[model samples]
Each structure stands twice: as structure tokens, then as C-alpha cells.
Target: MSRAIEVILRDEIFTELEIEYPDDRNTNLLEQGMDSAGFLKLVVLMESKFNIAVPDEDLLFENFSTAGLIIHYLTEKTMS
Candidate 1:
């Protein structure tokens, strides 16, 4: 599942943001040129792709700061 999430993030980051996904999953996306719009696009994509609703409280920069973090957040979401 984490692998899948990483792939989706890589593809979407390239497709939607027109930016290369960092090789390091722990790299900060905001520092990599991911802006607010890109972030919202990712949130929507994750909801649609994973079939999970991300609560308002979970929509934090820390949660989506990197691919690894997103995978971790989604893994926890899917587990519950």
C-alpha cells in the first residue's frame, strides 16, 4: 500500500504540479515547489484514489510534507 501511495504521489506530482518528485521520500515537498494548490490537489487525489475521507484536522502541512509522511498518514487512515 505504501508503495502504491508513493507511485501515485510521484505520478500525480509530475502530472498535476509539473514538478519532479523528489527521490527522497522524506524531502520536504513545500521546499520542492509544492504550493497550496498542489497540496489541495494531492489531498483530493488521495481521497479519490484511496477511498478515504481526510478529516479537516488532518489537513496539515506536517501530514503531507513528504511522500513518506503521506504514505504513513494514508496507511493509518486505511487501517482504521
Candidate 2:
């Protein structure tokens, strides 16, 4: 799941948002300079590629500021 998230992030959002382990990517993307469009694009790609529905509430910066959050959500979705 982390790998998939990383691919979507790197390909759809930032070319440099590398995530070897989703749990380790605690960086605040917005604080670091990522824009809103990039974040939305990643979310869209993630929803399509992973077939996981992300709630509207999950669109918050706190929910997807890092790869770890993405993986955590995806992992939970895949498991369920």
C-alpha cells in the first residue's frame, strides 16, 4: 500500500515525495511548500488507483500531510 501511495504521490503530485516506508514520512507537505492542487491531484489518483474511497473529512491537511497517513488509511481500507 505504501508503494502504491508513493507511486501516486511521486507521479501525480511531487516528483520528489519519495516514501520508502509510509510510516516514516512525517513531513508536513504543505508546510514544506507543496500546493493545494498537488495535494488534490494525489488524492484523486489515490482514490482511483487504490479503489479506496477517502472521506471528505480526510481531505484535511492533517490527514494527508505525510505518506504515513496515506499508508495508514490505505492499509486500513485494504484490510477491510
* Cα TM-score per model: 0.85, 0.67
Tens-place lDDT digits, model 1, residues 13-48 = 457767678888889988788898888988888888
Measured with C-alpha atoms, the lDDT of residue 19 in candidate 1 is 67
For candidate 2, write residues 1-80 as lDDT tens digits. Answer: 66776666556545433323233478666655667776777677677767888899778877877766767777787778
lDDT for model 2, on a 0 to 1 scale? 0.67
List ranges where model 1 is wrong by over 4 Å: none
Task: Identify the leading candidate in terms of lDDT.
Answer: 1
Pairs that collide in candidate 2 are none
- State model 1's lDDT: 0.82
lDDT of each: 0.82, 0.67
- Clash count for each candidate, listed in order shown: 0, 0
